[model samples]
Target: MATESRHVTEYIDRPARVVYEYAAEPANLAHWAAGLGSSIRREDGRWFVDVPQGGRAEVAFVARNDLGVLDHEVHLPDGGIVYIPVRVIADGENAEVVLTVRRAAGMTDDEFDRDAAAVATDLATLKQILEASA
Candidate 1:
């Protein structure tokens, strides 16, 4: 079975370089991605996030690059890794941030819709943060 993926995009009125710099930082995830938890902490060369439920998730973020590639994987306690692919592309004088979410196996349509909406909200928050600073 093929998995379904949704790409949620938000535009920020800033240069791609500036947006990329802000978005590529793993530490910034807490400020924008509320679904990822607000209290992400790094310890022993590993980052961890408090899951909304009753547990903490070990998160491994990809190395930051000059290009806006903020892909990360959430390491679930059940040994499953959920990959989140995010990018910022230059759009003339502005920047477009796109986050791709894949519908996990057996996820219902309602769940996927809610997940996509959450991702969109997160991206909007990101745009607001970067624009407000400029």
Candidate 2:
């Protein structure tokens, strides 16, 4: 029961530590992740964002670590959960960010392609923001 997946990556011209630090912050998601809505808020020690699709989705990011893991789970309003696996790996003096987009059980080919394209665009946006700020 393996699901189809796509690995979208972006090469950021910044140190891995710097890229991870900025991206790990929940507040910074609005700057690059348009798929997650443009604003995020914290309430009762939980992070929530108004997803582009409609209702709010609770986001739970992995605990801060030195291993560059930025995985997170998005709890949909309808009770479905989506797990996103992301990472920042050191590439010489720069960094490479990879996000794995999994095709949902009932998702069509067109939907999967759109999802992957969105992830790619988000990664590119991340690259632009981090590089320009450096």
Candidate 3:
């Protein structure tokens, strides 16, 4: 069965390479991705974030590549894994960052809407951070 999904995107006034480089770094997530956590830490080469729901979630990002894929998997404390698809697309002199938020199994409509809203806010935060730095 296909799950409901929404693409939350933000146009960042920065080069694709620059945006990708910054966003790809796990350490930088705390600066823009508050929905994930307020802070992130690396232990034994693994990235962990304090989930808002009260436990820590391990975030594993795909290996860096020339392609703009920033896909990652979040391992929840309850043994559930959520796959998040993210991408950085070149837009002339700027870049568009898109995050695909999927409605998890058995998630309610309100929950899905909230998830999308949080993603949108996070993307906007990313845009502000990158554009301000430029």
Candidate 4:
């Protein structure tokens, strides 16, 4: 059982209070999530992600809090599925986000690799936006 993993670390010049607000807000997910070219839809207690390259993924929200984890299941257009584990940790002047995606059918390893950088870029962009406002 090999798990696909990616990690991104950034030092934000802004305080946690400001960054966390944007990170923790469910609606604000689109702002950053879009960087990965993902469209998010929330309805019926589930968040759906429309990934053009991979396909549609739907995850039921189990729990979401200030310092907590969000679990989602990635479903392929061809009927394959895998679990995507995401965690958000608050760092004094920065925040740590870890997104782990399990590989599924119709998904290539390269796609996962690409997302690793895409996510980091998105976070860095967010960092820039928040720090600029501060």
Candidate 5:
């Protein structure tokens, strides 16, 4: 069955490379992504982060690149992998970050909207963190 997906974009007053360099680091997810955790720890060659709901999650990042591609798969506690695609693009001297969130099946409309909002908030935090540092 086809699923619902949405994309949210945030603009930051920083260069794309600077934003990408910081955001691309999987270690920084906890600082920006509330749905993830406040701290991330590496164990047994795998990276993990604490979830707000009292559990930890496994995060497997894609191969690093220089083109501002920061894609990773979050292994949910239920054995489902949520693929998150984040991009940092140059907009003049500034940068724009775009995130794509895919709604899982059986999610109610309200739940879907909430998930999107959470992502937007996280992206905003990311923008704040990056821009403030610039």
Candidate 6:
């Protein structure tokens, strides 16, 4: 297995604050995560999701917009962890959202590829949501 990182980004023609607010709210995850079956845990800053095809994962929010780091740890179904970093860069009224997913080590090729595809789909969904709201 090899450590790998994947990056996905989408540009939204909207105010950063608006995009940030929508993405930061966990309740909106299901709308933009491509049917990940997302739900936020009230106890911790955890987002639980069921993958598009199958399987489940949990993302524990590490740093949030409060610190300006949209980061989380994506816990795989089998107990492995992948670090996912996301950021929204604002330029005037437009904002770009970037999502970086990194597996430090011990992930199979198939897992990485599958996860990458899932992330890509989620990003597309995010773009749709943002544009729709704009």
Instruction: Please report, as a residue range, the 10-residue window in candidate 3 with the lowest summed lDDT.
Output: 2-11
Of candidates 3 and 2, the better by lDDT: 3
Better candidate by lDDT, 1 or 2: 2
Number of the predicted model whose lDDT against the real structure is largest: 3
- For 27-78, candidate 2 gives per-residue lDDT tens digits of 9999999977768988999999998888999999999999999999999999
Give Cα distance to truth, residue 62, candidate 1, Å. Answer: 1.8
**Model 4 worst lDDT run, 10 consecutive residues:** 59-68
Off by over 4 Å in 1: none
For model 3, what is the alpha-carbon lDDT of residue 58?
98
lDDT of 4 by residue, 1-134 (tens): 66545555555676655666666555666677664346777878666777766766664554545554655555656676656566656676556656654444456878766766676777777777777877
Could you tell me every candidate's TM-score relative to the true structure?
Answer: 0.94, 0.98, 0.98, 0.66, 0.93, 0.72
Residue pairs with backbone atoms closer than 3 Å in model 3 (clashes): none
Evaluate residue 63 in candidate 2 and report its C-alpha lDDT on the 0 to 100 scale: 100
lDDT of each: 0.88, 0.94, 0.95, 0.63, 0.86, 0.71
Tens-digit per-residue lDDT, 17-134, candidate 1:
9998887776787998997776788899888988775578888877978777879999877778899998989999999999998999989999999999999999999999999999
- TM-score of candidate 4 on Cα atoms, chains taken together: 0.66
lDDT for each residue of candidate 3 in 1-134, tens digit (9 for 90 to 100):
99888998999999999999999999999999999987899999999999999999999999999889999999999999999999999999999999999999899999999999999999998999999999
User: Model 6: per-residue lDDT, tens digit, 3-45?
Assistant: 5678877777887777777887766777777634555444355
* Candidate 4 Cα misplacement greater than 4 A, ranges: 35-38, 54-56, 101-109
lDDT per residue for candidate 5 within 1-134, as digits (tens), equals: 78778989999999888998888787788889886677898899899987776677899987778888888888878788889887888999999999898888888889889989999999999988987787
Q: 5 in model 4: Cα distance from truth in Å?
A: 2.4
Give candidate 4's error at residue 81 in angstroms: 3.4
Model 1, residue 80: distance off in Å is: 1.6
Q: Which runs of model 2 end up more than 4 angstroms from their true locations? A: none
Between the candidate structures 1 and 2, which one is better when assessed by TM-score? 2
